[model samples]
Target: MTNLSPSDKALVPFVSVDHMMQLVHSIGVEPILIGLADYIEADFKRWELFDKTPRIASHSSEGVIELMPTSDGEVYGFKYVNGHPKNTKEGLQTVTAFGLLADVANGYPVLLSEMTLLTALRTAATSALVAKYLAPKGSTTMAMIGNGAQSEFQSLAMKAIVGIDTVRLYDTDRAATRKAARNLAGMGLKVVECDSAEASMEGAQIITTCTADKQYATILTDNMIGSGVHINAIGGDCPGKTELAPAILERSDIFVEFPPQTRVEGEIQQMAEDHPVTELWQVMSGTAKGRTSADQITLFDSVGFAIEDFSALRYVRDHIKGTKFYHDLDLLADPDDPRDLFGMLKRATPA
Candidate 1:
């Protein structure tokens, strides 16, 4: 017996890209990442609180599209994103995304925002957070493979979060690497353009792959990686896309965000069903170890999780409280009389 009428319920606000950027800039990237990491960890620790499911995907000849949905009893969220590798050639982004946040109690959307830029930010932040735990202590140099739209954020996040001051870069397309290097030019990071992946990884403590390939390709071979190197696998985040040689994962201590999802999408998908890999939450919660020895090879298989997007939406909504750029969207409708639903639609039009 609830007395409140459905029409009396409050509407959820919608946030836009301008609002999202303003919020991120206001909160600062480093602080936002720190907060997101904490939120992700807390959510993972209470795994039972969420109704989680693997992302829904629609594959096409060009690329694949995915919808990731999750809920934590009170709030519900989902992201709509597509991966089209040929996009860059057509001057379009390889990925375009938007997401929605809703109230689980009523299944009404509260916020909607573009997730393209936010995805890049959150992915890089997740990489750095994982590296902070798994990489060798005091590691200051990193090798970045596959410099693309994600490259700049990866460079900045590692610099701001993990003290990485130098980035050795390489890509099949040299211009992409140069573009990334140019973007980092006065950002206090020393950029070294290299001829190959091996050259890029030389003497580096962390290696991050952010390539946009849509198929299984070996960007890193076991021979190129030396001892004590942490690999942040960012791209190759789908079923057929893989960056590491199968053997590379075999030689490393692997970690992932969500095992059920990552098993089908992460770089470690090449491994067998029973292959041992630690979930990052375990390390964050002290239930498992991150880097036991400086010489151990560590790999963080990041396939991007729904929780990250949830964290980003929370950040945007909390920070864009008074912004006028975002307006109310009529995604749901309620009538004062349950039997007057058709009348409500007719009433919406002027007579």
Candidate 2:
């Protein structure tokens, strides 16, 4: 078999968060969403093509930190992210993430990026993609619960993909709601800053929950959500964290990215062991139905899957062209003599 030398391997491209943001900005959010959805759908259709594993999570008293890794033969990718709800109170983001992409052929890194921004983008894109199948046609207004960094991206992606025009926002912190409202101003979206979650849901066709609390909190009750509403559940992705009450899940048809993992993380974790839930890949592949009736409430339980991060990294690597901004890390050692492993390490470093 042909092999690559150390110097040859260092030439592989690397991308930082700033570079990735430039890439996303230059490519634009709508196009990125479309491209990511296509990649995710294509991979989903060939579900067996991937080397998948459930994410590894490190739980703390206050929150959780997770590592999600996956591969699709040619590429290996992993994201490092933490969920600390109390961080915002300390002037820190609730979530801060970074990820890397490597060539599986030689196990060389192709890119390294801050996934804090990319996560928001990918999660919103995944939400809109699910809504494309489940939300009623001509859906305009959306009620956004827990306005934070993710809220703006979610609103934009929904507008681009599913034709949402109005966003009614609510958060325990008024400033958070105001931030979301301000971000959407003049973007052709009518923003309503509501006092409570129920007020935000008034006459909304779509309900998006992206709150960042780490406890088992109920953001949506049976009384707030009505028929024909598509719920993009983004925040309640951990075992002890839930945004919707048990009755809400019992009444709605649930859709998830990956059922086995979602069963432990998504709102379905609150349901019975045998409770029915549909995998989104099946819906995209036409093996399952999305919404049966206009009055049916549909929920997309989003726990941020590795496949989504895989797709996002792939998109950035492919489209973020012509920038030589990445560093060359000496992650591997090369040797002309395969048997001299120790000698190769000695030669890898400078004298």
lDDT of each: 0.83, 0.84
Looking at model 1, residue 329 earns an lDDT score of: 62
Q: What lDDT, from 0 to 1, does candidate 1 have?
A: 0.83
Task: Score every model by TM-score.
Answer: 0.92, 0.92
Candidate 2: lDDT over CA atoms? 0.84
TM-score of 2: 0.92
Q: Residue 67 lDDT in model 1?
A: 96
Residue-by-residue lDDT tens digits, candidate 1, 225-308: 888889998997998999999888888999988889999998878889889999887888788899999889999999998877
Displacement of residue 168 (Cα, Å) in model 1 is 1.7
Task: Write candidate 2's Cα lDDT for 170-274 as tens digits.
Answer: 999999898888878888788999999989989899999988777798999888788888999999988888999999998899998888889899899998877
